[model samples]
Target: MFVECCGCKYYHDMPSNIYEAMANPEAVIRPRGNVGFTGALSMTVKCPWCSHEMSTKCCAGYAAMVYVKERLH
Candidate 1:
């Protein structure tokens, strides 16, 4: 599938087993990162077309969780 974020586009190959997961209408965790003193950060996005899952970061913490929940559902 293809995703557009912040004016950038990302493409992901749907794993045979996870293809259905992409249609769950919920956001799924994608990637994680650290923000040193802030602890961790994360980014999350909803597939605008399918309402699937996508995320990134590690230190963003609750912000990430909130983003996931808000964007997915």
Candidate 2:
């Protein structure tokens, strides 16, 4: 997945382990230094290139969730 930086307009590629981390929080690296994400439907992540904060809901993760919900129901 790619995260676009609002500051620099850079698209940062997300780690491949992100899906595993979403399913199991303990399985991924914390890029933003102990940002708490417990019980949250979405998260705030920093743009790797520009250090600009962005919402995870804008990413494909939420779309994937919607797709899964549609497929399941």
Candidate 3:
């Protein structure tokens, strides 16, 4: 699936499952402009199977969780 950031033109390839995507560090972060704020921007993506539009919260949360898990291990 493809994910596009609503705040910017940034886009990424998302895995079918959140956990799987989280496993890859590179897939978790995207370059964002200096908005002088800290939070995940909303994003919309087209579903490859049905061409439906989908939305997700900030990816930062997912990345942070994964980082925490890794540190604990």
Candidate 4:
């Protein structure tokens, strides 16, 4: 599984179990810290390609979410 950055179209690799995450009726997927997502969501992330701040409603490690890719953009 993988995700893409809306800005750059960069693909972010996702977990193999991602299908299950989407299959669960109770599973909620939304960008982390994104107010657009209501209630407790899944993950927070940043774009490695464009250095843009981003979030996802999937399972991504915190290590992948720590880069500050903005301001330089």
Candidate 5:
């Protein structure tokens, strides 16, 4: 599974255990950040194609596609 860059919409691979991390109640990726290009957390991610940074807390899966799509507007 992977997340898309908010800048170029390029799909970047997520950490193999990201879903697992999300399940941890103690995990705190924060609601926003800009550090997912190389070392991605459960929150932020950067664009590999354009280098644009954006938050990924709410758009981490297909279930959130509606919310993520709404954000594009």
Candidate 6:
């Protein structure tokens, strides 16, 4: 999975265990200097290429799609 940075337009490859992390109730990734909830279904991380705060909606969407596919299969 990849996330696109809005500031620099860089594509970031998500971790393999991202779904597991997101599913964990205690798992919360907050970017430095950022406060408040990013979104109900999203997390925030710094862009490796540009140091910009990026939302993990792409990762979340990918996980949801994969979960649905697994359930359907």
lDDT of 5: 0.49
Could you estimate the TM-score for every candidate? Answer: 0.24, 0.34, 0.26, 0.33, 0.35, 0.39
The most accurate candidate by lDDT is 4
Instruction: Write one digit per residue (lDDT tens) for candidate 4, span 1-73.
Output: 5566666876766553443443353556644454664665553345657775544453333224556667854
Better of 2 and 6 by lDDT: 6
TM-score of 2: 0.34
Q: Which stretches of candidate 5 lie over 4 Å from their true place?
A: 16-44, 57-60, 63-73
**Candidate 2 total steric clashes:** 0
Candidate order by lDDT, decreasing, is 4, 6, 2, 5, 3, 1
lDDT comparison, 2 vs 5, better candidate: 2
Query: Candidate 6 lDDT, tens digit per residue, 1-73?
Result: 6555677876555674543343352466443344564643435366667776555443332322333445544
Candidate 5: residue pairs that collide: none
Clashes of each: 13, 0, 0, 2, 0, 0
- List, residue by residue over 1-73, the lDDT tens digit for candidate 2: 5555556767656665554453344343545545666433444366666665554444344322213445544
What is candidate 6's local distance difference test score?
A: 0.51
Arrange candidates, best TM-score first: 6, 5, 2, 4, 3, 1
Off by over 4 Å in 2: 16-43, 57-73
Worst 10 residues of 6 by lDDT: 58-67
Best by TM-score: 6
Candidate 5 lDDT, tens digit per residue, 1-73? 5566555666655554454453352454443345455443453344557855434454344333333445555
The 0-to-1 C-alpha lDDT of every candidate, in the order given, reads: 0.36, 0.50, 0.45, 0.52, 0.49, 0.51
Better of 3 and 5 by TM-score: 5
* lDDT for position 73 in model 1: 45
